[model samples]
Target: MNKKYVLFAILPFALSACQSFPTHLKKNEAMIVETQSPDLLQTLSDYTWIYQSSEKLPPIVLDLDAQKRIFIKTGCNNLMGAWQFDGKQINTAPLAATQMLCPPEFMAQEHTAFQFFNQAQLNASINISNPVHPLLTLENKAGQKITFKGEIKPEAKYKSTGEVVFLEVSPNKKPCPTDNTQQCLQVKQVKYDKQGIQTQIDQSWQVLPVEIQGYQHNTKQSKIIRVKRFNTKPQTATPEYAYIYDMTIEEEVAPQK
Candidate 1:
């Protein structure tokens, strides 16, 4: 795949920070005396990490262990995989995947995801100070860094309003395949016209910046592909609704290999 296309497809978890070391580190000698080393595998087994990928409208949490067991919940689908954790490395292979087929944009994401875990090296660690979150660093053989801040949650609820939203397609500007045609990113704006209540909804899409077939092609063009059904609705106190809409941003840029 073209590097640009590959990048577009590969990024899902692409975006954290603070410098304070844990208190134990401050008292290194005391910590060493009191803290016994925990087995890495045992410490991370069955732990979950929140993941944000380009394909899904919302982030997801991934759960896996040494038993070759795995599970994940994207905003739209529940997925499964098989995992392996040798003393020094971890590997994951997706098992049977469902065919709900999210939007075209999300479809690209699904493909990207399969490509990601099919064969990748993963490093897992914990935040001793905050057990609720686990840190994961995924890297290719080249030692390039693909890291993120992930949260552990047993369940994720989804909310959706019967509505349409806009998304920004990246790689801001480029030349179209045809003469005199230009390709650029587009931002979508969605709202409930009935009440005139508007919400700027962020979305996922498989964008194609190509020229129109056979016309003068005066205007540079880009394709807009809607990915999945997202909960663009504002948060509420009650969870009575089946789905909720959320508009959030996750940029795509990682340490290069």
Candidate 2:
């Protein structure tokens, strides 16, 4: 062999025989570190999480209850399911969703979200270094990650179970019976059976003086809305029934009187 080739061949063997070479090579081999587990059930319960980033659709809302129930609002459709959290892993059951035609973008976003939660196993982590602004991250075996930021809900803040009710709001805001100067929404309670069939609808409309927490009224359209009613103890000046809009069922213009 040529002198140069012999030197090169021996150099690699010599370096491999040195102890420092093993250490140097070990440094380059990547090591996979496992993530620490946190109290997932406690951290995830009761709060509502909104997706921080989305393509062209509205932010998705996620809610986890203490009863292991999961609720999701995917811009257009409402989904319900159950979730289980072991010490280190999380799993979700089959989710049922409302069948409503939505914009193509919204539907695509919903499909992506549904697939994320419907995964067989997911690893969850919560970063609470900043208590005021906590971050939740979920990772799957496929290396896909989804992050969410949460806000405490009104009922969750108070640690109370809210009464859920549905209301149909008239398209036009009529004058309040007590105060003609104040315009109010004409609303009526709608009742449903265990099977979710509409059992009763109050024909008489009542004037809703106060606005619903999450509802945005459209001046041109009526809405069938679901609301959560919370009663504050040691009643303050606030209304007896504090309403938070859950979802809108129908959007149509009410007949003008």
Candidate 3:
């Protein structure tokens, strides 16, 4: 085994998980941006707005009441901060947030709101006429933008389905690994259901696993299986045709030039 391969295997554990929010923006001078619709902005200012990401968790709600009090739900715990809105500027000073540690997922949501609040150069528009849906348009310091169509919905119920998948797994090249024999393998996807109803998994979509191992065998018995390398020519198959079942386990021989 090459010394380079041994060092490469140890590199995965070296990654550190840390998150920081930027809180250095100055607030000496007042700033405001004109909105296309004034009534929309007013309707937005009146109610507490919640932001829910695609993550499978509870929503993060931010309540901006009168008297400059800002209360936010960090998925698990509530955090309080000082906020002042002059004209259209919704300025939130650095929060004296609570030190309660929820799951890491909730912490990520808190960080997202912190960054969005800190970088608001202008508040464009907010329309909340429909109680179920609201529209918020925000602009950052660089004049780049994003539009969020907010909706309040109930949590979705999920279930487990017993279906197998044929999956092809490969380590990313460019930074090649030391294992020359072990490259990539395809496997069948495990089935899942929602609320006892079978869910549809997109065709050709792969579930990425952590390990570089190709064929997954039962631990009760030992088996030897050959697997293809990552850089092999990928065969493209259309959804209209039949689904390929066999995972290529050997080097595909090239034709004569």
Candidate 4:
């Protein structure tokens, strides 16, 4: 028996074992690195996400601000909080929300979502493997997962902050100031308190004939709605304020023609 031959036989086994362990470990490390990249955060920041887990509830919308703060809309109420991402792990601060009363179903959905986000060691992953439709996934310690589909928010596309306000739209469409032949919805600004009480209402009405981005007016009724107003650059000839309908507050029959 030669010592050199025995050493070579054992050497192959040691090398095989050494390689197997790291290869297994590298696969996991790569998976973690893939999700923790800053690009993932940038992808998330580019669009507002709509929660797709529940059909009965209104889609939840999220906007990440410049300061790393998150603004959330759970269909009926708004919430604000700080969020941070550290190597595939997602963490959130205590969230503050408006005290709006909503249906029991929506309230329950909101609470469940809040708990999911506050989980200490939640994991986040994005599926951009498909370009046309990107998905965001968040998984809690209990293995429960919430998924969201992304939609470009106005601020992301327009490159400006939108002023969020509420407007009461008149039932009757009055003659447009610019073009009398075309009738318009007489809109007035309305304000609400933290408790969702109507704090102030504008007495004067202004004619708005153009289509608002997120608002759909029903000719059969008048409505009080929340809207986002974006300001255009002064250099452009476009109208100063661009309005998008957010949500309807009150609905009533149209006034007699």
Question: What TM-score would every model get versus the actual structure?
Answer: 0.39, 0.64, 0.38, 0.61
Q: lDDT (0-100) at residue 223 of candidate 1?
A: 26
Q: Write the per-residue lDDT of candidate 2 for residues 35-99, one digit (tens) a residue.
A: 13234456678467778465667888888766556777889877666665655455666666768
Question: After superposition, which runs of candidate 1 have C-alpha atoms over 4 Å from their true positions?
Answer: 1-38, 54-56, 76-78, 123-129, 142-144, 148-257
- lDDT, candidate 4, at 200: 79
Specify the poorest-scoring 10-residue window by lDDT in model 1: 1-10
The digit string of per-residue lDDT tens for model 1 on 1-257 reads: 01122112222221101112233233344234224433555445535566676553666556664344565555545556555554334555434455576777666655555555554555544554555555666665555544445543222223222334323334344544343366633334333333333334445433333322122211223322233343333475532212112222223442233
Q: How far out, in Å, is residue 30 in model 3?
A: 7.1
C-alpha RMSD of each candidate structure in angstroms:
17.6, 21.1, 18.4, 20.6
Order of models, best TM-score first: 2, 4, 1, 3
Residues forming the 10-long window of minimal summed lDDT in candidate 4: 1-10
Give the per-residue Cα lDDT of candidate 3 at 105: 82
Q: What tens digits encode model 3's per-residue C-alpha lDDT throughout 1-257?
A: 00111011111121122112135433333223223434443454455565567669777676554434556666765555555444555556545455668789878877766666542444556666765667666666666554555542211001111122323232222222445445323233322243322233234533332233334433232121222223112254521111222232222222333
In terms of lDDT, model 2 sits at 0.67
User: What's the distance in Å from true for residue 179, model 1?
Assistant: 68
Residue pairs with backbone atoms closer than 3 Å in model 3 (clashes): 165-187, 165-188, 165-189, 166-187, 166-188, 167-186, 167-187, 167-188, 168-186
Task: State, as a TM-score between 0 and 1, how close model 4 is to the true structure.
Answer: 0.61
Off by over 4 Å in 2: 1-40, 76-80, 94-102, 129-133, 174-207, 234-239, 249-251
Comparison by TM-score, 1 against 4, better one: 4
